[model samples]
Structures are given as structure tokens and as C-alpha cells.
Target: MSEPTRRPPSGAATLRADKTAAIAEAVLDELAEHGYGRLSMEAVAKRAGVGKSALYRRWPSKQRMVIAVVSEPTVALADPPDTGSLRGDVLAALHAVADWLTHPRFSRILPDLIAEAQRDDELRRALALRIGEPRRARMIGVLDRAVERGELPPDLDRELALDLLGGLVYWRVSARGAALEPGYFERAADMALRALDARPRRA
Candidate 1:
């Protein structure tokens, strides 16, 4: 008789992934409601409808759990919002990010995450990968599309241009530690466009 077929535990893995996702969402809500200083593992576990041991099996500390929750992948932009020009593209992206940050939960949670990052290298690295790099890449794609269409200078330093565009939003967020006002993104986009499109002034 042939040996019994060996099978991977795909169902178990799927269940674990689903449970982990639930835990992460619960942790995010707790962090948003109570802030990191006051967050409790037991509360998150209870809220997620999982046992404490299960939460502990996945994450050993509140810091790690919070990092995982905050770094969850965001929804992609809808249709890339082409307005037939580079400035329009930049404005669209800025508005998207601004709208995300304007949410009460995100605005409250992000500052706590940044504060945690200052104290924890592992969390900081995770944030850089899950949040920082992806955001930078998306902005770069928008700029590259503009360059390809002759909307922006082909020789423009894309990395610097991305920084010029993204850094302004981060600056306000990090500095003010509050929800951004309307028109803030538009103003930042205007400034970034001027910087990117400026001509060399004749001396």
C-alpha cells in the first residue's frame, strides 16, 4: 500500500492568520482609545475575543503588538487620480495622505507610534518598512509617471522630490501633533511644485 499522502496544515495557518489580524485590529482600537501608556494586553485580548495566551503567542509585548497594529497595510489609492499633470498628481497624493491622517483614530495613534519608535529600535525598523518605505515607493511611482509623460524634468532627483513632497506633511504632523487643517495639503503641494519646477535664476 502507498504511504499516506503528506499534507500541509493550510487550514490551521489560515485560522492563525485570521486570529492574528483580529488581535491586531483590537490592539489598534485600544491604542487609539487609551494611548500606548495605558494600553493593556488583557483588554486587547478580551476585545479581540481571544485568550491572553493566544495574544501572547503572537506578540510578547504591548509595544510589539502596537507596532504591528499601527503598521498594518493601508488601502491603496483609487485609480491614482490622474489630473493630466505632475502638479495635479502630487496634489492628489497629498490629499489622499492628508485624508488618511485626518481620521480621528489615525491622527491620535500615529503620534503614539512615533513616540514608541524613539524608544524601540525594533519597532522603529518595523515602522520604517511597513509605513515609511511603502509610502515613499508609491510617491516615487507618481513622480516617475509624471516624468515619463514629460510633465516633470526627466533629470529631477526623484528621491529628493519625494522628500520635498512627503516631508512637508510629516513635518506638520510631527511638529503640531494634531489633525491637519483643510488646505494644508494644497499649500504643501504648491510649495513642492514650485521647488521641483523652479528654473535656475540667471546671476
Candidate 2:
């Protein structure tokens, strides 16, 4: 006698990872093109080549779908590498922020999401919870290590540090539309270090 394998009562979402990934990407494209205020489940389904029902099965609403999909790349880039020294760590953080801000469709999608959230209180809160908080918490790890290494003051303003860490880069790329030139990463890292009053590691 053989035993039958039990499956999810809702069916095999786990088996449709590729389809889910495609849908997520489709959502990004739609967001970049139409903005969150204009995005529709049908548009995403058409772009993804999946039925509208497929989306509903995964998410109860458009906002839920957007947050879940957008949060993937946002959260994935949270943890910067431990480069030992505060300068190295700051440089790493700058690089990570740059990477996320300039990501293909996400670069455009993010700005749209931000614009839409500005007018919608609920959307803003959802973004903060699903995307902002997780990313902020991960970024705090970099400053925490600097504090432990005695490179930063014990009373370091970590939230402020996080702001200054990615602020300039975000402004330049996401707002000012400036290209990242050679040495820009180092310059940004140095500026953040200055802002944080970081003590450089002794050579």
C-alpha cells in the first residue's frame, strides 16, 4: 500500500514560483507605467499572461499585491556586507542603496508608489510597514556594528545616521536624476561618516 501526498487545501502555490515571480514583475512594469493610482489587476494579469483569478488567489486586493511584490526587492537589499571598518561599512551601505534605487523597473515603480502614498494615508502606512520598516531595521545593523567597534559614539543618532546614509544618493538618483560618477560612492560614504562624526579606524 502506498500513501498519497497531501497538498495545500488551497492548491499548489508553492509549485508556481515562476508564475508568481512573473506576476510580481508584471506588477512592477504596470506600476512604473501607470502608477499605483492607475494600476489594475487586469492590466497586471494581461502583462503577466496569467488570469485575473490567479492574482486574486494570491492577494485579496491590488494594494496587497503591490506591497507584497514591491517589498521583495526593497527588503532583499536591506543587509549590507560587514566591511569591518565604519568607512567600509558606510561605503557598502551607499552601494546597497544605490543598487536598490536604480533597479530596473523598481526604480520607476518606487517613485510612483511614493507619489501615490503621499495622497493616500492608508497606502503610506502600508508602505512604511511592509517596506520602510524592514529596510530601516536592516540598515540599522550597519550603524550598530560601528557602535560596537567603537568607531561611532555610543549615543550615535542611528535613525539620523540611516537618513543621512542614503539621503544624498536617493536625492541624486531618484530626485535630481543625476548619474553616479566614478568616486561618487566613496564621496557619499565620506559625507555620511562626517555627518555621523565617525572616528576613523587607526591604520
Candidate 3:
């Protein structure tokens, strides 16, 4: 009788995870080097040392793959630290934003992606839905906590507050090319708190 068919090793799960991570890292590098407008699945697969089929197995399209690879880490890194005070929380959030914006790979990738998104509706929507919305929700939670703690008004304009926090850092670091000085986040936090008219809790 024929022997039982030899089964593949049980390492498939681990192998898949490793390949996924490799592909993600390769995607970032490709985007940083080539920008979103020039990125291709072929390039990413070659960079990752995987077959193009490996990428297609994971993501159905280049847009989906790029968005997932970029947005997952971004949203993960964007978890605002709960410092139990609006001022502290604001500083933590801004610091995280500064770190990401100045990161070597992201610093290169983001500006190009932003420029491309301006002209590509599909890309714009993917960025908004995947990266923008999650980050905004987190910031809104930060503001909601501030309100609960009586540190901000119940009717605070969360959208404007988000704009203030993100805009200040983006303009300085990404747009204007200014260096982040020591205590920059603290100073920005103070300014943001003042702008939002944040108040101290009552006994």
C-alpha cells in the first residue's frame, strides 16, 4: 500500500507572519525611496525577497496593501498616553506625532503620499478611512476624557482641537522644516490648552 501522503510542516503560520512583516517593511522602504506615485507591487515583492503572488495573497491591490502597511503601524503608534491630565495627555499625543513625522522613512513617505492623495480620490479615501479616521477618533477620546475630568468644556470643538494639535506640529516639522527644540511639545501643549480654554477641575 502507498504510504500516507507526507504533510507539509506545521510552520506555515510562522512563515506567513514572517513574510507579512517582511513585505510590510519592504513596502515602507519602497515608498520612502520611490514615493507613492512610483511604488509598485513588483518592486515591493523583490525588496521583500518574496514572489509577487505572496503579496497578492495578502492584499488584493497595491492601494490596499500600501494603506494597510502604512496605516497599521501609524494607528498602533498613535495610542495617546493617558497621563490623567489634559495637559499631559496633549503633550504625549503631540510627542508621538512629532516622532512619527520625523522618522526617517515616514518623513520621506508622508509628504509624497499627501501630495499624491491630493490628486487621487481613491488614495485620499483610503488614507482618510484607514489612517485619518482612527487617529481622529483617538484624539477625540482624549478630549472626551478631558471633558469628563472637567478640564475642558463639554461643548469643546474636538475637530478644531485636533486640527490645532496636529496642525501645529505638521506645519513646524513637515511644512516649514523647523527643528524640534527641547520642550517643544510642552510649549505646544500649553498653547493648545490655552487655545481650547481648558480649565482646572474644581474640588
Q: Point to the candidate with the largest TM-score.
A: 3
Q: Tell me how far the alpha carbon of residue 95 in candidate 3 is from the true structure, in angstroms, after superposition.
A: 0.3
Model 2, span 46-129: residue lDDT tens: 999999998887888999888888776677776678888888878878888888788777788888888888899988999999
Which candidate wins on lDDT?
Answer: 3
Question: RMSD in Å for candidate 2, one decimal?
Answer: 6.4
TM-score per prediction, in order, is: 0.74, 0.89, 0.91
lDDT of 1 by residue, 30-76 (tens): 88898887788889989989999887776668776665555544434
lDDT scores for all predictions? Answer: 0.69, 0.81, 0.86
* Candidate 2: stretches off by over 4 Å: 1-15
List runs of model 1 lying over 4 Å from the truth. Answer: 1-21, 57-64, 75-83, 177-185, 198-203
Question: How many residue pairs clash (N, CA or C atoms closer than 3 angstroms) in each of the candidate models, in the order given?
Answer: 0, 0, 0
